[model samples]
Target: MNTTANHTSPPAPRVSKTRRRLPVLILAALLAAVPAHHALADKNDHIEARELLKRGEIVPLARILEVVQQRVPGDVIEVELEREDGLWEYKVKVLTPTGRVRKLYLDARNGVVLKIKDD
Candidate 1:
C-alpha cells in the first residue's frame, strides 16, 4: 500500500476586483456630481435671496453701505451682497486704517460682522 496523502492545492488567492472598483466608482461618481450640485445650490441660493428681499429680512443696499462706512470710518470702495454656501451676506470693500484695501462680510439680516479680510 503506497502511503501517499492526497495534497489538495491551497485555494487560489481571491482577487476582489469588484471591491476595489467600488471605491473608485464611488469617487468618480461624487466628482462628476459636484459641479451639478454646485449649480443647483447656487440657483437655490438666488431664490432664497429673492425671498429674503421680499420678506424685508435683508437690509437695503444703500443702508448697508452707509452702515459699513460709519462703522469702519473709511471710504467704501464697493458694497455688495454676496451669497456664499447658500447664505446671503454683505461684502464691503473699504480703505482701512493703514489705507489698505479690506473686505468684510456682514450678516444680511442683522448687520453683524461675519468676516473681515484686510490687506
Candidate 2:
C-alpha cells in the first residue's frame, strides 16, 4: 500500500493444436495426391498403348527397333512412343560407332522413318 502502482498486461493469444497442424496436414495430403494421380495417368497410358498394339493400330516396338537399326546402324540407347496430332510416333536414340548420337523419329503405324537428327 505504498507508492507502488500495479501494471497488468493482457495475456498472449492462444492457438489450438489443430490450427497449428492444419497447414501441415493439408500440405502432406497434397504431396501424397500428386504422385497417385501421376501413377494413374501413367497406368492409363500403358493400357491404351497395349490396346493399340493388339488392335494393329500401332506397329510393334520390336519391328520399329529393327527398322531403326537397319537405317542408322548403331547401338540403340533410348526409345519412346508418343501420340502427336492424332498420329503416333516413335523416337529412337542411337549411339553410333564414331561416338555420335542420333535421334530418329518414325511413324508408329508403318515403321517409316520420318526424320533424323545427328548430334
Candidate 3:
C-alpha cells in the first residue's frame, strides 16, 4: 500500500480588495483623462481664432491670402494658424506658378512671411 503523502505548494496569499482594485482604478482615471485632453486641444484653436478675430488682432483670411498671393503669385491651397514660441503664426501652403509647392509661415498678427519652405 502507498503511504507517501502527495506534496502540493500552498496557495498564494490573497490580495486585499484595494490592492486588487488599484490597477483598475488607475486605468479608469487614465481613460477619463484622454478625452479631456483631446477636447481641450480641439477647443483651444477655434477659441483663439475667434477671439483674435473679435479683437481685430488678426487680419481676415482674405487679406492674408491676398498678401501671400502678391508675394508668391500662387494658388493658396491650405491655410492654418499655429502657435509657436509663444507667438501666433499663419501657415499657408501654395501651388506656385512653376508647379512647386511652398509652405509659407506668416506672422498671424501682421501679414509677414516668417519663413518659406519648399515642399
Candidate 4:
C-alpha cells in the first residue's frame, strides 16, 4: 500500500491582483462619479428654488395657477417652470371646457401672463 500521503499538497487557489482590486476599484469609481453627477445636475438647475422661495424671488405656484385660471379659463394639464433670457416663467398648458388646449407663459415673479398659444 503506497499510502505516503500522496507526497503532494493540493494546488493553491489562483488569485489575480486585478481580481482583488476589482471591488475596491469599483467602489472608488462610484465614489468619483457622485460629485461629477452632482455638478452636472447643478449646472442644469442654475436656480436655487428654495432660496428663491425664501427670498420671494418667485411667487407661489398656487398664485401662478390662480392667475393662469383667471386669464385663461381651463383645467391645468401640464405645467413647466422655465428660465428664459433671465426671466423666470411658468409655461402652463390648460385644457378649456370647450376642449381646447391653450398654452400660457407667465411671469413667475408676479403671476403675469407673458404669452398665450393655442395648442
- Top-TM-score candidate index: 2
Ranking by TM-score: 2, 3, 4, 1
lDDT of 1 by residue, 1-119 (tens): 98999999999888674564455434322222122225333334545555666797776555666677667766565554555676557776777767889887888777777878874
Q: Give the 10-residue window scoring lowest on summed lDDT in candidate 1.
A: 28-37
lDDT of 2 at 75: 66
User: How many clashes does each candidate structure show, in the order listed?
Assistant: 0, 0, 0, 0
Candidate 1 total steric clashes = 0
Clashes of 2: 0
Tens-digit lDDT string for candidate 3 (40-87):
344345555666767877676667777788878766665666666766
Clashing pairs in 4: none
- The number of the candidate with the highest lDDT is 2
Candidate 4, 21-113: lDDT as tens digits: 455434322222122225334432434554555688767666877788899886676665656677667777888889999999888788888
Q: After superposition, how far is residue 75 of candidate 3 from its true place, in Å?
A: 1.3
The list of candidate 3 runs beyond 4 A from truth reads 1-47
TM-score for predicted model 2 compared with the true structure: 0.63
- TM-scores, in order shown? 0.50, 0.63, 0.60, 0.59
Give the whole-model CA lDDT for all candidates, comma-separated.
0.60, 0.69, 0.65, 0.65
